[model samples]
Target: MVWDDFAINNLAIYLLDKPNKDRKVALFVKGCDSRGVVRMLQDNQIKRENIYLIGIPCPGLKDPKTAARGYYKDAGSVPEAKKCEECRHPNPVLYDEILGTPVEEPQEKDRFAEVNELEKKSVDERYAYWTAQADKCLRCFACRNVCPACSCPDCMFDCTKPRWLDKEVSTEQNQFFHMIRVWHVADRCIECGECERVCPAGLPLMQLNRKLIKDINELFGPFEAGLDLEQRPPLTHYETGDPEELM
Candidate 1:
């Protein structure tokens, strides 16, 4: 099936549960989804020989909420999703077969532009800004559920034994929840932006992810997770020349 704006679900996450490991399967993938597949392959979560990948270049999906607001004259004129606008990879990075002619990758934009602006503010200002955003969170976990990078068998939030977080939805608790989740996925997040899209609270979750990505890039010398199957994540590997700021 051809993926369009309506097909926003990340198929890579579903394919992780291979009922019959020996049975081969094939699925269509967009630029971001293909990266997630490669990531699973790198982690040995899925076998490359067990599946066929059909890659397709993405022109970008439109925001359904924006479309519902009568923002476009026609469906074809709908504005591109904010995440797609900042996407550096519109063409699939890995595939067994390509569905159509590859499109040229868009020029790299300031992906961390918003993050940089927030950093210019005072510590208290930044804290207040994030606190306000966190207060609106419903704790629905839709963001966590939709993220392809969050493949943890037992997410901390759902663990009742240790009860990492109390059931109360206070501002402090909310912020703590979000911060911990972001840090956990900092090294592996592919920036698919699915978390933000699925958030019922309309929180700008991508801003937080982009902030971590920007910091990691600056400190670790420009690493992009899931791009190379052989490459180790910055957090998982160490180098003698690595920055000592964290120390």
Candidate 2:
């Protein structure tokens, strides 16, 4: 079947021109979404003064449109979102309120297993595979838009001056957009698997994210990006005698 624009976790920002007293304004943040929200709270961009947080237990939510019958047939009963595969934190560590029953931390799947196998393959094989996927690019920015961490009003691709990409189908341009965008969000990415779901090209985008998540875990320690508002992200923190970052 062809990919409809809404087939994935296609983000649609419902705009309200005027405020509504009866309407509740809340972001349906997944566990990872809460983390970025906590991070912003830590940074003081948003005030907790006029907000209502509705937290849900996520064994993981999938794109019902794209999820194959056997893969993710039931809510919270699926193979797992790629982010959940390596998820170090599953439940809310901090919240004023929560919804649904309390969820236990999930037994993590081996997130790096695929990346390790890919690494075993020769560089040429990896390049060929990635190029084939990248060549199918339609420049859909749905991946970035659906991500909770990617709530940016403007993205680099939206810029025109000295345009970073050709805006045309080309292996080089597509690869550059994918690689650069990944790197840009690497430190901040919550491994939510939103990108892979939104990819019209069906690129295994989670692999790139999982690799970074694994490296961060190994280098900095088992870090959960936005678990605690009081604590600093491992990437932004430093400790002496850390040898991993040197490698």
Judged by lDDT against the true structure, how good is candidate 2? 0.62
Candidate maximizing lDDT: 1
Mark the regions of model 1 whose C-alpha exceeds 4 Å error after superposition: 18-23, 69-73
lDDT of 1 by residue, 178-228 (tens): 999899889889988889987888999989998888888988878887788
Q: Where is model 2 more than 4 Å wrong at Cα?
A: 1-24, 39-45, 67-88, 234-247
Q: State the lDDT at 23 in candidate 2.
A: 55
How far is each candidate from the true structure, as Cα RMSD in Å? 2.0, 5.8
TM-score of 1: 0.92
Clashing residue pairs in candidate 2 (N, C-alpha, C atoms within 3 angstroms) = none
Alpha-carbon deviation at 32 in model 1, angstroms: 0.4
